[model samples]
Target: MKHFYKAMIGLDLTEMDDILIKKTIVYLDFLGIEKCYFVHVAKDLAVPDEILRNHPELLAPGDESIEALIKNKLREFDFPASMDIEVSAEEGSHPLDTFLRWAKIKDVDLIIMGRKEELAGTGSLAKGVATKAPCSVLLLQEKRPPGLPKKIMIPSDFSDHTDLIYDFGERISKEMGAELVPVHLYEVPQGYSKTGKTFEEFSEIMKKNAQDDFNRFIQKFNHNGLTCRFILNDGEGQGKALLEEAKLIEADMILLGSRGRTKSAAILLGSVAEKVVLANNILPMLIFKKKGETMGFFEALFKV
Candidate 1:
């Protein structure tokens, strides 16, 4: 596991003491993420510039009550190790700007934050941070059930870039003693919709295409075990349908690589992966970047 020693967490007041927040920090600690830099941006501070400098209504000279709040919340966490936890608050007129600037300065390897409800401006945050973050970001939700430790679910379309998540997910599953699941949505063409075939007939055809793609997707990972739970689904929109399938499978975590054929594939795919993250409802998404002609772990560790 890559060590996440210098870590930062972006937080809001509503996310205070969230179970996902605690579990994420604990998981990182288990994987050797020592010395966490916890940051919380206050939401409702509307002090004008004139009041901030001349009057200073909300805060005193070097007043740090908000900073103290971060510490107190961190103390509530059950950390596995004695890691240095620095608490700070970023002050700005806007919430997004304040948090983003702090993240840039810290230069942390991983950032953890709680997911808000779908309607309450959280989707906008996921879109902004996933595209613009200085490092890999992990999005956490409050009170997610601890599901299948030995079974992981991943959606793939087998592009050159989508293939990278296969290796990445394999490593994480190996560490946690879990199995990997690769899913493909079988959306038929618009003309096929008028056929009105029976589901059994439709399923047979979709399953055939899905299995062929799945086999090619796993060809590179020889050491990866061959047992996988295959799923076949058809829908109008890619994102909504996948979430429904994920619930049916009872997947522990949804993992996806950022690679798509459409616009802004690097940042926005609107695929199952992106929607799972934005929906921020049923599961937590672990996103991986699949770019460049890179070396594998064995090559990096032994050869280097």
Candidate 2:
């Protein structure tokens, strides 16, 4: 079974850290995760000379203090004894760069981070990690409770990458005893009326075409006799349509594949994935990616 082995959780030393830790514990067994790295990055670890002179008791480095606090927080929870857990507090002006570096160094297979809605920090870190990380990323909604998903919604385009997305969805569903809901969004052409068809007629045609494609695509995968629901969306925006369907189905999580860009490209995630990440603030989303698929590009882009 394809499963995540090592996961890195980004901590900000806020209340969100507790939620993320609890969520990680809930998913460790389901994802088959063997190791975890709880990492916190500070903009600067240097203390001002003036402040240090006044407070001579503050002799320890900032990283040490931050690391100790994180360790104490972890002690509050009861993690599995068999899992290898590591805590790191590092100084980096650009946190996304630091996270990517650590993920590569640790050979991490998954990166889990909190997506703030009414929380303190903006969700840019989670978006950036989802866009550029070499491995998969799970963006947990701060407002949502952490637990096993009952139904995972996957947005499929019937591309070659859909196979990879379905593989992950199937593995997670089977292990966690959840249902798989695959959604396909189709759009009617701008000049559908030119084909002597009404707008409504053209819409139905598009939906039927999408259903045909989905039937063929799903024929190749073994769903383990699970009840898989197929949905068709013909809305204006693919990302928005997918989210609406997720809400209609009361999905617990949204899982989708990301066709990452090369080093020369301006963006990493495709347009729809990026849009969904930006607008979504309700459900936990897992962006699946082939591990180490972009290592060469990342090395060149970062000049490592």
Candidate 3:
């Protein structure tokens, strides 16, 4: 499978720092991304006349001094000039709107953002962008992984889209020379006692059932060049269990699939993926939609 070549990175100026700036460069370098754009949207791009007069630099030229500053910092990193990169700053009512619009205009294949702990909630801007983006999104919560990932974790619910999820997971694992761990999180029925079985017994039965499905899911796929394994976690919270498993295995990254906004209006980014991201997990996460998927409300309303 071909890798993501065109990339768009969303930047929140208030949270900018040396570490995240460096991580962005590292990701572009590792992915061999050919064209990249660093974008920032200012909610209050217009300054009061008095303040502007006092500080003319605030609206330097195109009111893009922040973008210019970021570009200068990136230049200090000394990445090869061959990588095509541009900086964009825009004034908009909402940051998410600006980002999604920029992504469409540029035809970006991958969207990258630094995971802000405060904005990791369901209604936060990060969730909006991830849910509405036209392409894949990589949420980075820490410094870049030292090299290509050694282990990529995929939390599966055995949904109908598991095939597409597995295919992309396999492709990424093979590219990174990493092992694929497909995990299923299960929970016993609420009224298991009605089945004439103890909670422990019922839990074990459900675990086995999930394991069987996971195994069959793996067997149906052709992962000749990749190492794939199944992990079954019987627990209450799927997101918590997945994170614990990833930490236990020292997984470098987590690959997940979104149900797409069109699937359901309430659950954006899927409940599990949202919890995992909002939990402030340390691993990088790549959440994407199925290929050829149609645009959702946000995408259609904000078309470039």
Number of the top-ranking candidate, with lDDT as the measure? 2
Model 3 alpha-carbon drift over 4 Å, by segment: 14-17, 29-32, 46-62, 117-123, 143-146, 223-236, 260-268, 296-304
Computed on alpha carbons, the lDDT of every model, listed in order, comes to 0.59, 0.78, 0.69
Tens-digit lDDT track of model 3 for 74-151:
778675578888888788887787777888778777888776544333336666776667778887774444345788
- The TM-scores of all predictions, comma-separated, are 0.74, 0.87, 0.82
Query: Residue 301 deviation, candidate 3, in Å?
Result: 4.5
Instruction: Count backbone overlaps in model 2.
Output: 0
Per-residue error (Å), model 3, residue 129: 1.8
From the highest TM-score down, the ranking of the candidates is 2, 3, 1
Clashing pairs for predicted structure model 1, backbone only: none
How far is 62's C-alpha from truth in model 1 (Å)? 8.5
Prediction 3 TM-score vs. true: 0.82
Compute the lDDT for candidate 2: 0.78
Error of 1 at 23 (Å): 2.0
lDDT of 2 by residue, 89-182 (tens): 8788898898889988898889999888887888788888988888888888888887889999887777666677888788778777888888
lDDT of each residue in 265-289, candidate 1, tens digit only: 4433435666656554557666664
